[model samples]
Target chain A: MTTPTPSSPSGPSRLDPEPTPRRDFLGLASLWAAASTMLFAAIGMMRLPKAAVLSSPSKKYLVQLPDSLAPGEAFEPPGRAVVLFRDEDGVYAMSKVCTHLGCLIKKNGDGFDCPCHGSRFGIDGSVVKGPAPQPLAWHKVTRVGEAYMVDEGVAVPTGAKEQA
Target chain B: MSDSPIKTSQSALGRFWRNLAGAPRAVWRAAFRSGAPTTDRTRSQFVFNNIFLHIHAVRTHRWSLRWTTTMGLGIAAAAAFLITVVTGILLMFYYKPYPEAAYDSVKDIHFVVPTGRFIRNLHRWAANVMVVTVILHMARAFYTAAYRRPREFNWLIGLGLFAVTLGLSFTGYLLPWDQLAYWAITIGANIAQSPREVTDALGITAYFDPGGFQRQLLLGSDVVGEEALIRFYLLHVMILPLALSTLLAVHIWRVRKDGGLTRPADADRRLGPPPGDVYPVFTDAPMKTYHLAAVVRGRSPAVGKGPENTVPSMPHLFYAELAALMVTVLVCLALAITWHAPLKEIANPDVPENPAKAPWYFLGLQELVSYSAFMGGVGLPAIVLLGLGLIPFLDREQEGTGEWFGGPGGKGLVARSAIFGLAVVLLVETVAIGFGWIREWYPEAPQLLITLLNPGTLIAAAYALYSMWLVHRYDSVRSGAMGLFTCFLCGFIVLTIIGTYFRGPNWTFYWSMADWPKH
Candidate 1:
């Protein structure tokens, strides 16, 4: 530890007792009041970006399965992230969003390929290559009489499918 | 009182005339406290009196005025930034930030608003110029080893300035809301999300995803849309400019505090001391004997220096600064007049541009991303930036502080490093392009392995090995740093050129644009 030289300016000294305790109490109370106000203000400010209502495309969308779609073929609904597939196993929906970064994967032949990163997923939504740790997610598909309701926000088991 | 001097003017008309006659002198005096600087003392006072000009020292080393030393790159960058600010503010008058109106506003600025196109073009050209000049300025500082001793902090600040410069450029790129801007920003946002690669590989993304967090923070959502446009606009117009200006002030202030610029130790002797010593000899007899002077902890910049080699900054330094600013303005104006900043069709999210490229500066990174997204975009850039930040700290030797390439031997080292770097990058890219990566050969390859062993990582590893070899050969840290920096520079240039010119649709390699298959 370094000691100050004789010529050096001295460090802080012991503080004297408060001359006006009541005044000090009042000042402290006001300071706390201001601090709490600011804290609440900051908390309120933080809530602005976490909006209660978000202006975005609805996650749950209804997509009509194309009648012409053959077995094992995928049909991507416009403005939706899920790809509906019709196979002998019945009807299923796989999310086209790449698990790696979120670039919409294109259906390359039977599997899906990410354009940003080369992550391939099998037609069954199984990871066929590395870089993409998880397989393409399977979205919940509920049979709605004529059209199927696909929930893009919900992920189900890989083989879960709705009866055709 | 009225009888004194010639007959005093007692009338109101006479007083008004006298006040009017004295107004010019009063205004001039208020602006410049000192008169014309005929003498050295007045010249010093001239600088000291002006708040704006006082950042510069009264006396500057004649060597600093030499064009070959710094190449005026710093001032050029400052000039370009100034031009950018002026033109940016002008464009802001008619330019809207909303996604709905941003594209049309840019078109109006391009074709409708009088002189708006010119202002926008100038802003664009000057911003690019600023980036280039700032980069070159850093290169100048590095090759000269100016980051030694008292100037290391300033060098770090310079790096911060460079980063802010790039940030400004990236943010500004999205304001037009065109396909180019939208797609480039999309690629940029994706790059920000590259941390997912590692997190996913480790099977930890479900619990913690920093990549996604960063992307959300940057674009305010998953993708570049309305939120992203507004966020980038705020950053471009306000936040980044404030940051840059604050850092720039400190940077220049530190330069003055650290003694104008780094110069040779024997600079005064080399230049043969300005005409003669301006002060009386104080080192003689009684003054030396009576004064009890102790060695100080830090260097005394003026120690043992006669005043002969230093010239007043009044005309010399100001003249040089003015010339640099003028040249920068002229070049920017010439470019603005000749070219129209490109604006492609408005952004269409459904129609993704094939082979979508990031801005040219980041194209090198994009090329690396194609190799391995996480490694190329995030991991390697982090490593490179960390290495750059550590350069001055690692190479602490104070010798060869002012000469280019750390003295004569550095020239050969830099040349060799550049050539080696160019060859290594080309060879690695060529191999990767011709035969493909391990993943291409083995479909079952692990991502962790691929991330650690791609063309980007290979080139970086090669550069590190070359730098190590240089350290061993020269037995000097400076030589190693010089090698590494030179190699990195060359690699970036090569990668950027290839990314811009060679890569085509689906990121396939082609010799020329003509050879690329039509979409």
Candidate 2:
């Protein structure tokens, strides 16, 4: 055999540079698989909801009342709106929207009191408290040819008086 | 040639005088050898030829000098660490790591041993200064972008160093075993164990339950007591220091590898040819001819010799670092002599502490814990910290622009917008937290309004979110400015009105015994 020449001024000549070690390949493969699995798992976890759902039955009630109630009289309905009248027998359904801030008013004794700001409204929807400047809003109840249907469409201002 | 013989002799004499005064013949002989190819000997010759001697015999940047800053800081910190080791050894002579002896040992340090207080204070102040200096150095590196490119790995190492610093501080904090250290560390560890609130917000839980086993492993028992003191003592003295020193060496090595301090261009050029090239050799034979020409012009060849340039970590840097070390040592000594670290009454494991506060750095988080158990306890803070740590990984661009967001070069508009939004949210939350109790006391007018604003804190948070969105969409700068102003104002209001004025004995529970039945 011909004399093998040295690659450089350094020691030793390699014969067919040693094949890649099997352990290195196995180690690299395992690392790759582990990393991929962790990444996928993290992404999957992000889609879950953070808050618990509330379970209460009282939130679903609806309100129903006669077309119109007389002024100075009030209607406390379970579902939709609490009504307060401004004058006797002359019907008016006052929406319970509290004038103090916009919280629904609860009827106390002779008038309506706002729980949020403590604003009080008289039987006729007049402002009785210092915090609330304006009276409670009165809903329009038109007599459509004696059928006694209350018009829930229009809101009548508390200051406006209907002509007979 | 024959007519100028007298002139040539005079020139030769003048040249000899010049070489003697400045560039000595011996220096030339050391620089270049006769009958050798210049290229073959260029590298070695360069080192000896230059008057401004450097180890590498090449030019480099001046900002590279700040690497010296890091090194100097580390050395100073190490000196403090050494002091701590010596003092700790001394204390161990009399001190016991058991709970029974820990407090007694502290008392001995204060009242019993001669100059024991001095040793203890020296350790404490050195630690405090080390932490502060490390932070400042980090900030300097961050602003200068010294952490960019090849240096990123070192930055990570630095982060590890920072962690070690914190660990050392924490473990040392408990050595005193008094009320302040005990409660503060207890709260601090609790905070660490609690899931970060931000992470919870993101609905992510890498939940690994740390049972009593883990606690025992960490504290050497279920609670912070004698076992904990011993464990902390070991960690502070032995484990962390070893880890820190090992990492510090690696950190310095990486800096050397990356390239010495980044300097202004002019300063860099003044050093010599750029790094890697050998400077030209000045041989005695050539020197004699050059000197003759210089003598003919009646000028000294070495008159314009510039200031010496050096590679970082070389002799020049070594001296500067020593100077910095001296200053640091004197400061540590002064602090050790005058001040005593805070140590409260002995801890009673049976009594629960009221309104338990965390360490100062964790006050923001502790305040957060007061919000909601789910949000404050687990969600928000975790996300914030994780996100902060992940910033470097997320912004991986190659550009050197100093914008806070995105990979290096892109405009930081998105990042700025995000920061602004976050600022707004924080401001709003502060206000909400501050005024929540007041609003709770004064219910809104209508029942509906009360329902809407009953959790006034939530309303404030919602408002803050909305404001952030607004800033993101339109007024970015204004958003940040307003958000900061609002947070400040709210903080002031809370501190003055709510915290100082309204928080009474009922609110400010000093010890759990205040509320506990005295039977």
Model 2 chain B, poorest ten-residue lDDT window? B401-410
Fraction of native contacts under 8 Å reproduced by each candidate: 0.06, 0.00
Tens digits of lDDT, candidate 1, B96-157: 88895999999999999999888998999999889899999999999989988788899989
- List, residue by residue over B1-519, the lDDT tens digit for candidate 2: 266644545577787787688766567666654323234244334534544333232333334444433446655665666666677677677777767578888888878899887877877787877876776565445434456555667778877887788778878878777766676555444444433222332334345444222333556543466666777888877889899878877776666566554333344354454345423233333434444223221123434333234432333354565677787889888988778866677875432233334344334434443333223433443433343344345434343322122122123433443454445544554555455432234433432232223222343454456545645564442333233223323432333333223222212312233553343
Candidate 1 residues lying further than 4 Å off, grouped into runs, are A1-54, A98-103, A107-135, A157-159, B1-13, B273-304
What docking class should model 1 receive?
Answer: incorrect
Off by over 4 Å in 2: A1-164, B1-61, B66-79, B196-208, B211-216, B264-314, B352-355, B372-430, B437-519
Tell me the DockQ of each model, to 2 decimals.
0.23, 0.01
Tens digit per residue, CA lDDT, model 1, A96-147: 7666545677887878776654567888877666355457888898989889
lDDT per residue as tens, model 2, A1-164 = 34556576565566425556899889999999999999998877643321122221232222333456554456665444446343533545666754432345667788876543345677767765523434676666554554323444466676444322
